[model samples]
Target chain A: AQRVTQPEKLLSVFKGAPVELKCNYSYSGSPELFWYVQYSRQRLQLLLRHISRESIKGFTADLNKGETSFHLKKPFAQEEDSAMYYCAPTPPTNAGKSTFGDGTTLTVKP
Target chain B: SAVISQKPSRDICQRGTSLTIQCQVDSQVTMMFWYRQQPGQSLTLIATANQGSEATYESGFVIDKFPISRPNLTFSTLTVSNMSPEDSSIYLCSGQTGFETQYFGPGTRLLVL
Candidate 1:
């Protein structure tokens, strides 16, 4: 079974500090990884995808196959970055079905 | 990417009644999915609404309790039947084109009393 794990339910960091939201997945085949964000009162939106290899809103995630992790990281945390972050994994065969981890609520305190 | 819209942005419903959430995509999409986000939890996929076929539900979800309809490529609906307090959650519809990232709707917030 493919599963996504986000160990931290909540993470707090001071503004301007580095932030890392841990995510790990277990799957046999290659997986497509994604980071989705939902700000207060806003729709859930795709932040970034491993295939695109691009960063959005100053956040980036690298797929580490050896570690089975795709941790979201940012060099500096801003108050505006406070939101819920979810790590999702989609099997190569199942394009529409995805497994999402229990999201981590990131709070960037000012 | 596809643009998705969901109807009944927010609704407060009686316990024994039902609510139907509509999802529309701007363009024809290959895949449409329904997800539920319980309070303080991550999104869980409810079902895959395929065009011209019955929906495939995920574990912990059933067809009778959460009936889904996909009459076309760009439209789908999820009906929450016999709602309860546990059914109150944010229901989101997403459309995907060619296995890329999925575009999500604003979501329908249902509060069952």
Candidate 2:
């Protein structure tokens, strides 16, 4: 049973502050990692994926296979970034079913 | 990215009743999945609905409790049978495209009293 853990249940930061949402997984194999965000009253949308090696909405996550972690980071947080963020890891073979971590609710203060 | 939509965005049902949530994708997708998000909790995978085949459910989920139907690549339905108060959760439908990016539907909020 592979488990995904996001240690922080709530994170608060001032605007323009650097933010990092930690994510750790128990899977040993190469699993794909994704960051999903849910704004108020909006559907869960993909923020970024580790396989792509790209950044979206000023957020980037690097997959560290040795540590079994993929931590999302942003240099400067914006008010719009306040949302519930989830880290999901799926087996490379089955991309559809992903194991989601308990979400971290980020609040950007003015 | 594929656009996903779900029917009956929010519903309040009574105990012992069943509610079917419909998921529709704008384009054909390779895989469709059903998930349940309990309040203030992480989303749990319910099943993977395969077109023209029986759904593959997760460990805690069963075919009898959450029957799923995927007639084609663009559509699927999940029926929560004999609902109880514990079944109250947000049901989400997700479609995995060829690019392996998953697009999710606005979840259907279920409240069983």
Best by lDDT: 2
Q: Which lDDT tens digits does candidate 1 get at residues B5-112?
A: 999899999999999999999998878999998766798899999788899999899999999999999999999999999999999999977765778999999999
Model 1: colliding residue pairs:
none
Model 2 chain B scores worst on lDDT over the 10 consecutive residues at B36-45
Q: What is the TM-score of chain B alone in each candidate?
A: 0.96, 0.98
- Point to the candidate with the largest TM-score: 1
* Interface CA RMSD of each prediction in angstroms: 2.0, 2.0
Q: What tens-digit string does per-residue lDDT give for candidate 2 at A17-109?
A: 999999999985677889999998888999998888998988999888888989999999999999999998877764446788999999999
Task: Look at candidate 1 and tell me the lDDT of residue A61.
Answer: 96
Candidate 2 regions exceeding 4 Å error are: A94-96
lDDT by candidate, in order shown: 0.91, 0.92
* Model 2 TM-score (2 dp): 0.95
Q: Relative to the true interface, what fraction of contacts does candidate 1 keep?
A: 0.55
For model 1, state the Cα shift of residue A40 in Å: 0.7
Task: Supply the global lDDT for candidate 2.
Answer: 0.92
Best prediction by DockQ? 2
